[model samples]
Target chain A: MEPLLSILIGVLVAGAVYLMLARSLMRFLFGLILLSNAANLAIFVSGRMTAGAPPLVPDGMDVPPEVVANALPQALVLTAIVIGFGLFAFALILAVRAFRSLGTLNTDDMRVAEPKEKG
Target chain B: MSWYLSLPLILPFATAIICYLLRDRPSGAWVSVAGSALGLVAAIVLMALVLQNGVVAGQMGEWPAPFGITLVADLLSAVMVLITAITALAVAIYALSDVDARHGQLGYHALFQILIAGVTGAFLTGDLFNLYVWFEVMLIASFGLLVLHGGKEQIDGGVKYVALNLISTILFLTGIGLLYGQTGTLNFADLAVKVDAVENKALLTVIAMLFMVAFSVKAAAFPLFFWLPAAYHTPSFAVSAVFAGLLTKVGVYALMRTFTLVFDHDVGYTHTILLWVACFTMVTGVLGAAAQSDFRKILSFHIISQIGYMILGLAIYTPLAIVGAVFYLVHHIIVKANLFLIAGISQRLTGGSDVFKIGGLYKSSPFLAVLFLIPAFSLAGFPPLSGFWAKYIIVKASLDESLWIVAFIALAVGLMTIYSMTKIWAEAFWKDHPDGIDPKLSALPGRTALLVPVIGLALLTMVIGLMPEPFVTFAERSAAQLLDPTEYITTVLGPEAMQAADPLEVAP
Candidate 1:
C-alpha cells in the first residue's frame, strides 16, 4: 500500500512539473497547486500507509499504540494545507491583479514593463 | 509576567487583535507603542536569563520534548530577539503617523506586530517545522505591507518576491517532511540526538541541500537573492525599515541552527559550496551595489553581501567561525535596519532616497546627518562601532579556520562595504542638491519618533564597539553551549530520556 501510494504521488508530481512548464499563467498556477498537493500526499503516505484506519490511541494505551497511523504527518499535512491555501490565495490575487493591470493573463504579454525607463 | 520567552510571541498577537478591532483609532498607534516597549522588557529579561542559564526552554501545555512546542532562549536566540524587539519598537513609533497617513493604520499595525511576532517566534522556536510556519507568517505580513499602497511597481516587484518565496517555502516544507519521515521527530534537541543514527547519510545530504537552498533564498545569498534587490527598494520607508532590519537575519539564524543541530556532518560538502558562493556572493553583491546610483538600492545589494559574511562563518564550521556568525548577524541586523531608517530620514530631508536626484542633506538635517554617519561608520567597520567588532570576529574566525582565501574574500568585502557607505555619504550628504527642494515632500517634518530609535541604535553601535568584551564573552559562551548539545538537550528535556547510548557500545 505504501509503495502504491508513492507511485501514485510520483506520477502526480511529474504531471504537476509538466504543467508548470506550460505557457499560460493560469496553467502555471495550477502546476504549483498540483505539485504541492502531490508533496502533501507523499508526506501523508510516507509514514507507512494504513488505509481506513484513523490515527488515534485507545483508552488503555500507555503511549500511542504503534498500530495507530502516525499523527505527526497528519499535523504536518494540515499545516501544509493551510499554508497551501494561503499560497493559492495570494497567487490568485496576484494573477487577477496582473490581468486587470497588464490587461492579460498570458506570460507572453507581461514582457514590456522592464524596457529602459524613460528618465 | 516573567515569561520573556513567551511575551515576544504573545503581546504582538494580542495587539494584532486589538489593532484589528480598534479600527482607525490613534489608539492603535499607542497600543503598538506600548506593546513593543513591554515586549522589549520581556526580551531583555529573556536575554538576562539566557546569559545566566545558558539556554532557557519551556514546553507549552507542560508536555515533554518532541511532543509539545518548545520555546528555547539561548544566547544567540535571545540576542536576536533583543535586536528584533528593539527594531520593532522603534519602527512602531516611527510608523504611527505615517501609518495613519497611509490609512492602513489597522493593517499596518496588525502586520507589523505579526511580523515581529513571527521574527520572535523564529528566534525562539526549537522545532524546524514551526520555523517554516513562522517564516510564512512573516512573509505574508511582509507581502501585505509591500503592496499595501497598491502601486504598479510594488505589484510588479511583489509578484516576483512572492513567486520566489513560495518556491523556497515548498522546498523548506519538503525538507521538513523528509526529515520527519526519517527521524520521526521535529524537535531540534531530539533531531540532534537521532540525526547521526538515521539510516542513510545520502538522504540527510539531500535534505540538507533542500534546507540550504531554502535558507539561501531567504537570506538572499547569491543567485537566489535576485528577488530581494528587485523589490526591497520599492516599498515605503516604514516597510523597508522593518524588512531591512529583521527579515534576512531570520534566514541567517535558521541556517546556523539547522547546520549545527541537524546536519553537522555534512559540513565538508557545504563548506566547499558556501566558500565559493560566499566569495562570489560578497563580490557580486558589492559590485551590484557599486552599480546602483540610488541610496536604498545600493544598501539592499549590500544586504546580500553582508549575509555572505554570516554564511562564511557557518561554512567554515569552527567554534570561532560560529561565534563570528552569531556576532555578525546581530551587528548586521541592527546596522542594516538603522541604515534604512537613515534613508527614511534622508527622504524627508531632501524629499527622496535617490542619491542621483537628492543632495546636500547635511545642510537641512544635521542631526539626521550625524545619525546616518554613526550607523554608516559602524556598517563600514570603522573603529569604535559594533560593525568593527563583528568584522573583527569574522576575520579572526576565518584566520583560525586557516582559510586564507576566505579571509581575503572577507577583507575585500569589508573594503567594498566601506565604498558603498561613502557613496551614500558623498551623494546624499556632500553633493549639491539639483532640485533645491520639492516643497510638498520636504515640507513634512522628519519626525522625532523615527530619529529616537535610530539614535538608540547608534549609541548601541558605539557602546558595543568601544567595549566589545561583554558581547564577545556572551557570544563565546553561547557558541560553547551550542557546540555542546548535551547542555542544551539536557536542560530542555530531563537528562535521562535523551542520554546518548554509550559510544563504546556503538564502536563494537
Candidate 2:
C-alpha cells in the first residue's frame, strides 16, 4: 500500500511539473492543482498507513486508546487542503483576470509589467 | 502565560476584520492606521518583555509544548515582530494618501492589515506546521493586495507571483511532511532533539536541502528571484513598500531560525551551499538593478541584493556574523521601505516614474530630494548611516573568518550599490526634466500623510546610524542567544524536557 501511494505521488508530481513548464497560464493552474494533491498524498503516506480504528476518543476518556490511527497528519492534510483550495481559487481568478486584461495567457507575451527596451 | 506575545498577533487581526467590515466607508483606512498603531505598541511591549526575560513562551489552549501550538519570542522573534509593526504603521500612514478612494473601497486596507497579521504570526509561531499556515496567510493577503487595482501590468505581475509562490508553498509543505516522518515531531524544540537521534545522517541533509530550496524561493535568492522584480514594480507604492519591507524578510527569517536552531547537524554542507547562494545573489541582484532604468524596478532589484548581505551573515554562521544578519535585517527594512515611499512621492510630483521621463527635482523639491538622498546614500553604505554599520560588521566578520573572496564581493557590492544610487540621482533629480516640467512637492495632495512617514523613517535611519552602540549590542546579544539555543529550548519545552533529551542531539 505504501509503495502504491508513493508511485501515485511520483506520477502526480511528474505530470504537475510538465504542465507547469508550459507557457499557457491555464496549464500552470492545472499544474498547481495536481501539485497540491501530490503534496497532500505525500503527507498522508508519510504518517504510515496502518489498519486500525479511527482516531476518535471512546466517549468518556481524556485520550484515545492504544493502536489507533495517527491523527496529526490527517489534521495537517485537512488544513492544507482547505488553504490550498483558497489559494487555487485565487490563482484561477487571477489567471482569468490576466487573460481579460492582458489579452494573452502566454508567459512570454505577458510582458506588460516588464517591457523590453534596447539599451 | 505571557500575553504580550499574543497581542502582536491579535491586534492586526482585529484591525483586519474591523477594516473589512468598514471597507465601503471612508473611515476604513483610518481604522487600519489606528490598528497598526496599537499593534506597534503591543510589539514594543513584547520586545521589552523579551529583553528583560531573555525568552518568553506561551502554549495555546493550555496544552503543553510538543502537543499544542506554541508562541515563542526570543530576541530574534521579538525584534522581528517589532520591525514588522514599525513598517506596518509607516505603510499604513502612507496608504492614507497613496491608496486612492477606488482602491480603498475595494478592501485594500483590509488586505493590508491581514498581511501584517500574517507577518506577525510568522515571527511568533514556534510550531513548524503553524509557520506554514502563516506563510499561506501572508501569501493570500499579498495576492489580494497586489492585484486590487487591476491594471494590465498588475494582473500580468500577479499571475507570475501567484504561480511561483504556489510552487514554493507545495515544496514547503512537502519538506514539512518529510521532516515529520523522519523525526515524528513537528515542534521546533522537539525536532532539534529528535533530528539528532535519526540514524540516517544523509537523509537529514537531504531534508535540510529541501527546506533551503523552499525558503530561498521565498527569500528571493539567486536563480529563484525572478518573481519579485516582475511583480513588485506594478503594485501601488504603499503595497509595494510593505511588500518590499516585510515579505522576503519573512523568508530570510525562516532560514535563520531553522538553520541556526534545528538544521545545525550538517552545517558544513548546508552552510557551504548557503555561502555560495549568498555570493551569487549579491552579484546577480546588483547587476540586475544596474540594468533597470525605472525608479521602482531598480529599487526592487536592490532588494534582492540587500537580501544577499543578510544571508551572507547567516551563511558565515558565527556569533558576530549572526549579529550582522540581525542588524542588517532591521536596518534594511527601514531604508528599503523608505526608498519605495520616496519613489511614490516622486511619481506623484513628476507624473512619471521612468528616470528618463521625469527630472528637475533638485530645483523644484529639494526637500523631497534630501529625503531620497538619506535612504539612497544609506543604502549605498555611506559612513554614519545604518547601511554602513550593517555592511561594516558583515565584512568585518567575513575578514575575521578569512573569507577573502566573500569579503571582496561584499565590499564590491557596496560600491556597485553606490553606482546605482548615483544613476537614480543624476537622472531623476539632477538632470533637467526631458519634458521641461518642475516636479514640486507642494503639488502632491495630502502632503502631510505622505511626507510624515518618509521623514519619520529617514530620521530612524539616522538614529540607527549615529547611535550604533545600543543597536549593535542588542544584535550581539541576539546572536549569542541564537548560537546557544538552550534558553529557547528550555523556555518552550520546559527545563525537564531538555534534561531528558539525548546529549548527542543537543546543538553544539
Candidate 3:
C-alpha cells in the first residue's frame, strides 16, 4: 500500500510541476491544486495505512485493543486541506484579477511591478 | 499562568474581529491601535515571566505534551513576541494615516490585525504542525493585504508572491508528514528526544534538507527571493513595513528553532549547507540592491542580504554565533520596519518612489533626513548603532572559527550596504528634485501620525545601540538556551519524560 501510494504521489508531483512551469496563470492554478492534493495523499500514506480500521477506542478501555489507523495525520490532513482550499481560492481570484487588470496571464508580460530597465 | 501564554495571541484576534465588524467606521482604525497597545502590554508581561521563570510552557485545553497543542516561550520566543508587538503598534498607528478610508471600508484593519495574530502565533507555538498552521494564517492575511488596492502592479506581484509561497507551504506540509511518520510525534520537545533514536540517520538528514529548503524560501534566501522585491514594493507602506519587519524573520526563527531543537544530530552536514547558503544569499542580495533605482526596492533586496547574516549565525552553530543571530533578529526588526516607515514619508514628500525622479529632501526637511539617517546608517553597520553591534558579533564569530572567506564576505557585504545607503542619500536627499519641487515634510497630510512612529522607532534603535550591554547579555542567555535545551524540554514535557528518555538510565 505504501509503495503504490508513493508512486501515485510521485506521478502527481511530476504532472503538477510540469503544469506549474507553464507560462499561463490558469495552468499554474491547476498545478497548485494537483500539488496540494499530492501533499494530502503523502500525509495519508506516511501515517502507515491500516485496512478498514477506525481509530476509535472501545468503551471502558484505556487504549485500543487492536491495530488501528493513525488519527493524528488525518486531523493534520483535514486542516491542511481546508487551509489549502482557502489559499487556492485566493490564488484563483488573484489570477483572474491579474487577467483583467494586466490584460494578460502570461507571466513574462506581467512585469508591471518590476519593469525591464530601458536599454 | 497559561493566560500569560494566551493573552498575546488572544488580543490581536479579538481586535481583528471587532475591527472587521466596524470596518466602515473611522473608529475601527483606533480600535486596531488600542488592541495593539494592549498586545504590547501582554508581551511585556510574558517577557517578564520568562525572565523570572527560565522557560514557561502551557498546554492548551489541559492536553498533555506530545499529544495536545502547546504554547511555550523561552528567551527567544519572548523577545520575538515583544518585538512583534512593538512593530505591530507602530504599524497600526502609522496605518491610521497611511491606510485611506477606501481601504478601511474594505477591512484593511481587520486583515492587518489578523496578520499580527498570525505572527504572534508562529512565535509562540510548540508543535511543529501548529507552526505550519500559523504559517498559513500569516500567508492568507498577507495575500489579502498585498492585493487590497488591486492595482495592476499589485495583482501582478501578488501572483508571484502567492504562487511561490504556496509551493513552500506544500513542501513544509510534506516535510511535517514524513517527519511524523518517523518519530510518531510532532511536538518540538518530543521530536528532539525521539529523533536521536531513528534507525535510518540518512533518511533523517534527507528530511532535514526538506525542511531547510522550505524554510529558506520563507526566509527569502538566495535564488528563492525574487518574489519579495516583486511584491513588497506594490503594497501600502504600512503593510510593507510589517511584512518587512516580521514575515521573513518568522522563517529565520523557524530555522533557528527546528535546527537547534530537533535536527542537531547532523549539524556538521546541515550547518555546512547553511553556511554556503548564507554567503550566496548575502552577496547576491546586496548586488541586487545596488542595481535598484527605487527606494523601496533597494530596501527589499537588503532584507534578503540581512537574512543571510542571521542564517550565517545559525550556520556557524556556536554560542556567540547564535547570540549574533538572536541580536540580529531583534535589531533588524526595529531598524528595518523603521526604514520602511521612513520610505513612506519620503515617497509622500517627493511624490514618487524612484530616487532619481524625487529629491531635495535634505534641503527641504533636515529633520526627516536626520530620521532617515538613523536607520539607514545603522542598516549600513556604522559605529554606535544597533546594526553595528549585530554585524560586529557575526563577524567576530566567523573570525573566531577562522573562516577567513566567510568573515571577508560578511565585512564586504556591510561595505556594499553602505554604498546602497549612500546612493539613496545622494540621489534622493542631496540632489535637487528633477521637476524643481520642494518636497517638505510639513506639506504632507497626516504628517504627525506618520512622524510619531518613525521617531519612536528611531529612539529605540538609538537606545539599543548606545546601551548594548543588557541586550548582549540577553542574547547570551538565549544562545545558551538554544545550545542546551534541557530546561526547555523539561519545562514543556515535565521531568519524568526526560528521565524516561535518558538512555544511560535505561541501560542501568
Candidate 4:
C-alpha cells in the first residue's frame, strides 16, 4: 500500500510539473492543486502502513496498545489537506480575478506589472 | 517567561481580530497602530529575557519537549523577533498615512497584522511542522495583502506570487514529511540529536537539498526570484515596504537555522553548493537592479542581492561568517524597509516612482534627500554606515578562509550596488523634475507620520554604523550559539534528555 501510494504521489507530481510549465495561469493553478494533493499524499504514505486497530488508547491506558496505527501522520495529513484546500480556493478566485482584470490568463501576456521593455 | 515567548505571537493576532472587526471604522487603522506598539514592547521584553538568560525554551500547553510544540528563543530568534516588531511598528505608522480609506476598509490592517504574527511565529517556533504552519499563515495573509487594492497590475503580480510561493510551501511540506519519516521527530532539538543516528548519510543530504531548494525560492535567490520583483513593485508602498524588509529575511533565517541545527552533517557538499548559489545570486540581483528604472522594482532586485550576502555568510559557515549573516539580517531589514518608505514618500512628493521621470528633490526638499542618502549609501556599503561593516565582516571572513574569488565577488557586488544606488540618487534626487512642479516634503499630506519612521530608521543606521563594536559582539555571541547548540538542546529537551543522547556521539 505504501509503495502504491508513493507511486501515485510521483505521478501526481509529474503531472503537476507539466501543467505548471504551461503558459496559461489556469493550468498553473491546476498544477498547484495537484501538487498540494501530492504533498498531502506523500505525508500520508511516509507514515508506514499499519493493518492494526485504531490509534486511540483503550480505557485506563496511558497510550495506545501495541500494533496500533500511527496517528501523528494522519493528523499532519489532515491539517495539510485543510490548509491546501483554503489556499487552492484562494488561488482559484485569484485566477478568476486575474482573468477578469488582466483580460488574459496567459502568463506571458500578463506582463502589466512588469512590462517587457521600460518606456 | 512562557508569556514572553507567546506574547509576540498573540498580540498581533489579537490586533488582527480587533482591526478586522472595526474595518469599517477609522479606528481599524489605529487598532493596528496600537497593536504594533504593544508588539514592540512585547518583543523588547523577550529580547531582555534572552539577554539575561542565554536560551529560553517553553513547551506549549504544558507538554514536555519532543512531544509538545516548543517555543524557544536563542539570541538569533530574539533579535529577528525584535526586528520584526520594529518593522511592523514602522510600516503600521506609515500605513496610517499611505493606506487609503478604501484599502483600510478592505481589511488591509488585519492582513498586515496577521502577516506580522506569522513572521513572529516562524522566528519563535522550535518544531519544524509549526514553522510550516507559520509559513502558510504568512503566505495567505501576504497573498491577500498583495492584491488588496484591486488593480490589473496587483492581480497580475499576485497570481505569480501566490503560485510560486504555494509550490515552495508544498515542497517544504514534503521535506518535513520525509524528514519525520526518517527520524520520527519534528522538533528541531530532537532532530538535531537523532539525525546522526540515521544511517544512509546520502538520504539525509537529499532531504537537506529539498529544504534548500524550497527555502531558496522563498528567499528569492537567483533563477527563482522573478516572482518577487514582478509582484513586490505592484503592491502599495506600505505593503511592499514591509514585504521587502521582513519576508525574504524569514527565508534566510530558516536556511540558517536548519543548516546549522539539523543539517550540519554534510557541510562540504551542501555549503559548497550554497557558496556558488550565493555568488551568482549577488551578481544577478544587482545586475537586475541596474536594469530597472522604477523605484520599488530596483529596490526589489536589490533585496535579492542583499539576501545573497546573508547567504554568503551562511555558505562561508564560520563563526565570523555567521556573525556577518546575523548582523546583515538585522541591518538589512531596517535599511531595506526604510528605503521602501522613502520611495513611498518619493512617489507622494513627485507623484510617481519612475526614477527616470521624477527629480529635483535636492533643490526643493534637501531634508528628504538627506534622509534617503543615509540608507542608500548604507546599502551601497559606504563608510560610516551599516552596510560597510556587514560587507567588511563577510568579505574579511571569506578572505581569511582563502576564498579569494568569493571575496572578490562580494566586493564587486558591493560596487555594483553602489552603481544602482547612485542611479536612484542621481535620477530621482539630483536631476530636475521632468515636469516643472517642485516636489517638496510639504506636498505630501500627513508628512510627519511618514517622515518619522524614516528618520527613526535612519538614526538606527547611523547608530549601528558609528557604534559597530557592541553590535558585532552581540552578533558574535549569536554566531557562537548557532555553531554550538548544546545549550539550546539542553534547554529545549532538558538535562536528562541531553544526558541520554550523548552530545559527543556525532561526526563533524
| TM-score of model 2 vs. true structure | 0.98
Q: Write the per-residue lDDT of candidate 2 for residues B1-508, one digit (tens) a residue.
A: 5578898988889898899889888899999999999999999999999999889999988888898999999999999999999999999999999998888888999899999999999999999999999999999999999999899989988988988889999999999988887777789888877777888889889889888998999999998999999999999999999999999999999999999989999898899999999999999999999999999999999999999999999999999999999999999999999999999999998889998888999999999999999999999999899999999999999999999999999999999999999999999999999998878788778999999999999999999999999999999999999989889889999887766756332111
Candidate DockQ values, in order, are: 0.36, 0.55, 0.58, 0.56
- Residue pair clashes in candidate 2: none
Q: Scoring model 1 with DockQ, what do you get?
A: 0.36
Ranking by DockQ: 3, 4, 2, 1
Task: Show where candidate 3 strays beyond 4 Å.
Answer: A117-119, B502-508
- For model 2, residues A8-80, the per-residue Cα lDDT tens digits are 9999999999999999989989998999899999888878787778878889998887667788899999999
Best-matching candidate per DockQ = 3
Query: Regarding DockQ, does 2 or 4 come out ahead?
Result: 4
User: What is candidate 3's lDDT per residue for B106-214, written digit by digit as tens?
Assistant: 9999999999999999999999999999999999999999999998888988999999999999999989988887887899998888888787889999999989999
Candidate 3, position B271, lDDT: 98
**Across residues B71-92, which tens digit of lDDT does each residue of candidate 4 receive?**
9999999999999999999999
Each candidate's fnat, in order? Answer: 0.20, 0.67, 0.74, 0.69
Clashing pairs in 1: none
Off by over 4 Å in 2: A59-63, A117-119, B502-508
Q: Where is the poorest 10-residue window by lDDT in model 1 chain B?
A: B499-508
Model 3 error, position B433 (Å) = 1.4
lDDT of 2 at B35: 98
- In order of listing, the candidates' clash counts read 0, 0, 0, 0
Which residue pairs of candidate 4 clash?
none
TM-score: the better of candidates 1 and 4: 4
